[model samples]
Target: MARNKREEILDVALEMFAAHGYRGTSLDTIAHRVGLTRQGVLHYFPRKENLLTAILQCREEVNREHLQAGHAHEDLPGQMAAIVAHDHQLSGLTRVYGVLLGESITHGHPAQEYFRKHYATVRERMSASFAERWGDRLPSGLTPQAAATALLALLDGMQQQWLLDHTQTDQPEIIRDVLTVLLGSPPVK
Candidate 1:
């Protein structure tokens, strides 16, 4: 589908933000990339933080859809493997998240609260789903919540490695190996 102006701006901004950290990319550059004026960009997003929020939300929606694609199975590690495979094709988006996540580590960064809330929501949803099928704790003795935290951390760490050297790091294989250890030797079918 052809993108509307706002969508076009967002697409360009996502790419730009992915290429450059949030602080490195400017609205003027984003506007120039999309053939818009500063005011035109502002018409959709009054602040850069707003644009960041919109971009994060869009990414979350897409990730949620990917995670849910295999929800019928009780195999969370499998679902996560699928998410890893999916993320490989969206490295730009992954870099955008990694950069912003690092910057958001500082207290009161604009994306700080959003990242905090996003993580809590993700952990809650993942744990809830896993708990329903696998019980509150995995065989590894980690609770579903703890497992979720570990899984997210693994993804972030692997993304950093992949972003640094994509040719050498196999993100999905690494994730799968870790998940096998955490979930079980055979990965629950």
Candidate 2:
């Protein structure tokens, strides 16, 4: 019962955070929507930042599970497209991630350090992967570090666009096409 209530609170918080951002959403709002008093919510979360931390941890675990499912091709391009497809499928989580990521850019945001470390880790891993796969440069005349940065930017930008008007964008296809061009190879599929 305790775990269930905590999960329920997390779900409501996730949706509200995605819709209103961390700064805009309040614990009172989350408590109200979750059918709990603020003190009740505090019983589970203790602090609002604690709640945000839990949500971010849950989000990371979910993404890690999807990425490790082993359905996508083992290659980098295939993995990249698979990631975008996965995000499209999990639109709610994606929205929360996008909203929190944008919010993290402001001064002294709670998630600022989280996103900073996240980007650094991802960029380091991606740059290493590119280097191992293609030496110093990808076929697009960009160095591995540059490619990694550009790839991250492209993924984030495409996600924002999809969130704005998903009907107009075929995100996976676009990612695959752009990746093919960037990697100087035929499309993954």
Candidate 3:
């Protein structure tokens, strides 16, 4: 079907972009990888920037689904743990995003708007979640926005470290430890 082919092209292009930086990936490479001619690929994505935008949009949808699934759990810590566990269980998509997001900091990167909007939306949703969970018990000076930003930063930093040294490090444990310190609770056993 037409939709299936479009999805296939998108998947292949995402893998290519993740493996090689955006500047290094080409429509020709993506077409060859997807077993399509350049013109065929162009039928689905007229421009490389369009393909990049599609990839980022798909990633945001997938991440929002995953986070929402975790949020269905009973408590904030449980939700956080589920999210962290899901990260460890999945392929390196999160790591790939981390790399791309870092690269997007350069001037005129194609994904700048995508990454900026992604971070803003994620921060707002997370802050709302934290406020819903701990509004009554939060320390007098604490703010939900600050807590959300800290949690996101911690997760990003921990995942980067895990990607660098998965053999010697346990990412979920480190995240649990950090959260325990922040929440003044015992670490997950």
Whole-model lDDT values for every prediction: 0.79, 0.86, 0.73
lDDT of 1 by residue, 123-170 (tens): 898788668867967777778888888888888888788778878446
Regions of candidate 2 where Cα sits further than 4 Å from its true position: 185-189
lDDT of 1 at 19: 78
The digit string of per-residue lDDT tens for model 3 on 29-85 reads 888988899999999888888987876666667766987865665345555666766
TM-score of each: 0.85, 0.91, 0.81
Candidate structures ordered by TM-score, highest first: 2, 1, 3
Off by over 4 Å in 3: 67-71, 132-137, 184-189
Position 39, candidate 2: lDDT: 99
Tens-digit lDDT string for candidate 2 (73-183): 455567777888888888888899999989999999999998899899999998998899889888888898988898999999999998998794467777877877877
Span of 10 residues, lowest total lDDT, candidate 2: 71-80
For TM-score, the strongest prediction is 2
